[model samples]
Target: MNTSLKALAVFIALAGSAWAEDLQDLPDDTLLGEVVTATENGEEERLLDLMREVQARGLLMFPKPQTCTFSYPDTEFFGNEIFRGAVRWGFGTDLRELAMSQGFCGCIYDLGSLDAFTQERIGKPAQDATTSDFSVFRKYRRSDWSDVNERYQNFQLERCGS
Candidate 1:
């Protein structure tokens, strides 16, 4: 009986190690898929850990803004010129408000659409005073907006030399 129990413990330990090794061997896309699943399932802690791994691997991509007129409701938007100045000067809330009031564009680095999913789930930004408006804008899915933005950016680049 003691021998059987010892064998069972060894099996469990081996299985756990193997599982962890398999996870480490997974491709970036597979790991990212797990990140999305964790986010969708409201596993915030898991998502954070996975995001850290992704960042550590340098898998994150940040494309430059194709135009200075696009609006990013998910994040604070500032035009190219204003963004440069803000970087050189400061990134105060006052500058962001001024940029928004002037109808300038905002730049948010894409995280494989993870930010959109997070925005949809979180409902409101910390400083936003408005009530949830997602219900009113249910027709336009986040993925749809992403596709439209990608096409628009491509068109803009093709039409004008960027």
Candidate 2:
């Protein structure tokens, strides 16, 4: 890794509880976190370990984690930024209340592993993405990924009752 990337990882790892609220739009299998960092974006097991380190420190989560991968060039609305990539992002709803009653309707965070095909799209999105563009998955939280996604799903289920 480059020095800048390494420094970024260190900075993220040592970040404060404020990270508990920082949000980013990542593709499926991307773990939901702020301070959590990984050396291998393509290694699922390694990514999970990184996420667990964050959870172990009580960072963030998405209970009942689900995922979707956009393999072709596609765009999705993630908060404000429009990301274009062969994306893999964690999926969930607003079940943060279950994790802790002390959160705001503030930030939605992202975390997880991804293959090299996924790239972060920059600039204005050509168009909004539809369901057809993504391959979705629903699974359990055995690791940081599973636990985070499970929380996300549970949050949505609990809040929306769907």
Best by TM-score: 1
Please list the residue runs of candidate 2 whose C-alpha ends up more than 4 Å from where it truly belongs after superposition: 1-71, 74-86, 90-143
Q: Provide TM-scores for the models.
A: 0.26, 0.20
lDDT of 2 at 14: 46
Residues 1-162 of candidate 1 have per-residue lDDT tens digits of 999997986676455445644444446666677676666657687677777656544455454444322233333322234432322122222233333333222322221232343344445432331234332233334234445445545533432222
Q: Whole-model lDDT for model 2 versus the true structure?
A: 0.36
Candidate 2 accuracy as TM-score: 0.20
Model 2 C-alpha lDDT per residue in residues 1-162, reported as the tens digit of each score: 699997986675545333432222222133343223444335365465556544433334545443433233333432223222222232222223223343222233322212211222222222444444333221212135645656655644543232
Report the Cα lDDT for residue 111, model 1.
18
**lDDT, residue 19, model 1:** 63
- Model 1 residue 20 CA deviation in Å: 5.6
